[model samples]
Target: MTDSARPRRATLSDVAAAAGVSQATVSKALNGRDDVAAETREIVLAAVAELGYRPTTAPAASSRRTIAVTFDIPASPYILNVLQGVLVAATENRLDLLTRLPPDRAARGQRAVGRDWIAEQRASGAIGVVGLTLSHPDALLDAASEASLPFVMVDPVDATHKRLVSVASSNWAGARTAADYLIGLGHRRIAWIGGPEASDAARDRLYGYRAALDAAGLEIDPAHVVADQFDAAAGARHARAMLGMDLPPTAIMAADDEIAVGVLAAARELGVSVPRDLSVIGFDDTPQAPWTTPPLTTVHQHLDEMGRMAVHTVVAIADGRRPVSRHVELATSLTIRETTAPPPA
Candidate 1:
């Protein structure tokens, strides 16, 4: 055939472009690298087939699978504990676990950026994704859906997408239990310090606390309710202010263990002895909860189980099975420690 009439042969670059992945990823996928996610491999293979691209070397066979997990910075005990469960489940399932940070906030809201982010995940061989306390995930979730990638969120923050699948602790019930316990302890002036206003878990916990007070026929004290960051600093700041009030609360309920730690610090600074002058209760019985001064009495949420469930849910979705529910809430129990007692007379 004349050179002008001959069809152009497809190159590796063409396949990579078609697959929306890097050339390195294409090679890894073709070579059956264990690090490549199964879904990513399938994408590359499809591109190769569509473009009729052929490598000089024959492709290798492999059965490795991977999932991607994304989280924010300054990882807390709750996050670390949940990660432990994710790692264990990934190992048990014989899958590779990839950890990542989300894209920059400035660009993540753009549709194209979100799509590219999902493509990168697919390129890395991730068939599914798990997000831990990921905030503003609507764009990413939309892109994942368009690409048919399975995604699960654990304790998501500020996520409003209706199709989101997630796993979390029973926040409302847990908080209510904590409040009731304080009431049972003869602590009538109860105060609440909560997590961020945008957190659904935080809102649920606050509602639970209110519900408990209502059930006990106690009036809600707006002055005693404070919503702020989930860190110890926010907790300490709020606690100090509340403790300094002319009619101070006899007990305080914190949204998480970190915040509860700050509450302890503030009480100490003010010379208020725990369970003597005041009682404190916190949510999320993370590993650090038991190590707090006087060992914090907090609500026990199975964080690891939530992580394990997230992996299982994503894997099941990838297998073309729908989850039993879009949202799953694990049970919570109260872990009584040295920080709670009857209110000082």
Candidate 2:
């Protein structure tokens, strides 16, 4: 064959060009530099694969298998705690953990995009995947299954598929316990500020709150129940609105510690002293829970354990072993602190 007719070999420049990044960025991504963003790295790798470009000096391949963990924006203390467990478990099991941000929601519904996303994981040497509180993961789940990759969700939100494997705390029981405790403290008018309705865990907690109120023979007040995002801002917004009412609740149950923090802020702004005029309780006893103005009283969900369990379960599935159960729920308990007391007269 004539030399002129021969195909040109792809180079690092080709990959950089394909990925719309600089050559230095491509190099940084290839070398596993921490300074490189995860999304940029993924893009570079995809470009390299598409162009069939081989690195001139490949790093020594480690024996450790990799698992990818995907999470959304605004990482919370709860997520960080779970990640700590996941990291510990991964280290103990001699596996590499890769953190990823999920693909754009707008393109998630397309079959080609979903398949490409899974293909990228495979190309990156990921044996399994763990999603932390991911929303609308149906397409990704389907793609992962088609690729024969093990997938586990840690406290998944808005998941419609029933055949998924997941690890979470006993949300309903935990919420019920918190509500029952408030009722026992002479709080007849209780309000709930919870996470989004799309979340299964959020729904379960809401149901638990309702159940506790029913058991106490209290009327279910629609105005007292609210479902919103699991953040301090949402908590603060809802708390302010409720506190301004003619008949504000004596106690409020927050979906998570962050929300509880916001509730505290709102109460302070409204000149309502906690446990004097109102009581408050929150879920996900995150580390920050104890640092509030008056330390928060919250339901403790074993966040680290949930993360560890997810890693173990996904690894087990990757090794061709069936989990004893598709869904696992860890126990939750109330951590009493200064934030809760009997309602004022």
**Model 2 lDDT, full chain set:** 0.88
Which consecutive 10 residues in model 1 have the weakest lDDT in total? Answer: 53-62
Give the per-residue lDDT digits (tens) of candidate 2, residues 1-345.
Answer: 899999787888998999999998887776666899989888887776566565444333655688899888547998999999999999998887888888898887776676677767765667789999988888888878766678899998987776899999999999999999999999999999989999999999999999999999998778889999999999999999999999999999999998999999999998999979989999999999899989999999999999999999998988889998999999999999999999997
**Clash tally, candidates in order:** 1, 0
User: Clashes in candidate 1: how many?
Assistant: 1
lDDT of 1 at 193: 96
lDDT (CA) per prediction: 0.88, 0.88
In model 1, which runs have C-alpha deviations exceeding 4 angstroms? 1-61
Instruction: Tell me how far the alpha carbon of residue 228 in candidate 1 is from the true structure, in angstroms, after superposition.
Output: 0.5
Which model scores highest in TM-score?
1
- In model 2, the runs with Cα more than 4 Å from the true position are 1-60
Q: TM per model?
A: 0.85, 0.83
lDDT of 1 at 232: 96
lDDT of 1: 0.88
